[model samples]
Target: MPLTILTADRDLDDRAADAVPLPHAGADHWRRPYRPGPGRVGAAAVSLLLASFVLLSAVIIVAAGALPAAVICSGVAVLIIALALRFLRVGVWVSAHGLRQVELLRTTTLRWSEVAAVRTVQRPVRWLGLPRTVQGQALVVDRQGGSSLRTLVTDHNGDFLARPEAFERAADVLEAWAAEYRR
Candidate 1:
């Protein structure tokens, strides 16, 4: 479904600010809100291009009967694609039900009430974190410090990973949804 952002949540993380306002669900304008899937900077595309070069080179090596070299190059090409996809996992979602934290095989959704706060954490340098998938995105949600729920997020998904600032926009979406539903 298409996710058109109405307004964003401003105080989801601001301790000094008020709580996240909520709008009643099923309102005329109320529909699920999800963030734009991470932008594709063509990194994967570039990776593919490079992998093609490597595989082509492998073919040349094979022609010369350099079986070891060809196999090595072919293997390298496969590795490149795999690593790129790993570094760039896609499917980070946001909706009225809650925000979705995506991963390679499984996905998790954080409901509105369970949503404690959303904020951008500053690090000395950009970290391509994995497992939690906070690598490049700046939007870090403190899932109200759920007793057992671990935070959900994956590293980067192409270009959007580098622009975690988009998370602020993501936060706005959450805030706006809350306002519309004002429950």
Candidate 2:
């Protein structure tokens, strides 16, 4: 017997043994993997253009015999690449237990019991401190907390608004699940 086959069999056996039985677990558990939509792709394209511009600037600076300035521009380009990679990894995961928002730097989970309300609200994109783009619908999650009224999901960066219809559909499914499984 090959070691690879032995290792695979052992892994399968381990997973089967570790799996716990649930009373109601099959199709009731909803799952969604957030993928990049047209809006998100466009956003990424703009970032790529900006990065190219930065690289061009660096080349120009180096041609002018300014090694330090070119290094600074290269550093800025690296920072932009890091930030873009982080943004691309942002995702939302929905299950029977809760809705989890996964980002590059942080993850937040809100249980069905914790959620008070899920509603759409108008959000405007701003430029130079003034509203510039058309107002879009933002999915807001109201949750109960101590002190004054608290909220959980704000959709601050317009992730939920990127595809309003799809987002609303997902939100509707989540709301239905919450209603059915509220504890």
All models: lDDT? Answer: 0.55, 0.60
Best by TM-score: 2
Those runs of model 1 whose alpha carbons end farther than 4 Å from true positions after fitting are 1-40, 94-114, 119-138, 146-168, 174-183
lDDT of 2 at 161: 45
Each candidate's TM vs. the true structure?
0.46, 0.50
Tens digit of lDDT per residue, candidate 1, span 7-93? 233333467246444655433332334333334425667888899899999999999999998999999999988866754554445
Q: Which residue segments of model 2 deviate by more than 4 Å?
A: 1-36, 59-65, 89-97, 100-113, 119-138, 146-164, 176-183
- Candidate 2 global CA lDDT score: 0.60
Which digits, one per residue and each the tens of the lDDT, describe model 2 over residues 1-183?
557553313433456658775767553464553334444556767887898899999999999999999999999988877777666656656676876666668877777678766666676533212346555444566676622122222333434443454556555665666666556
- Clashing pairs counted in every model: 21, 0
Where does candidate 2 have its weakest 10-residue lDDT segment?
146-155
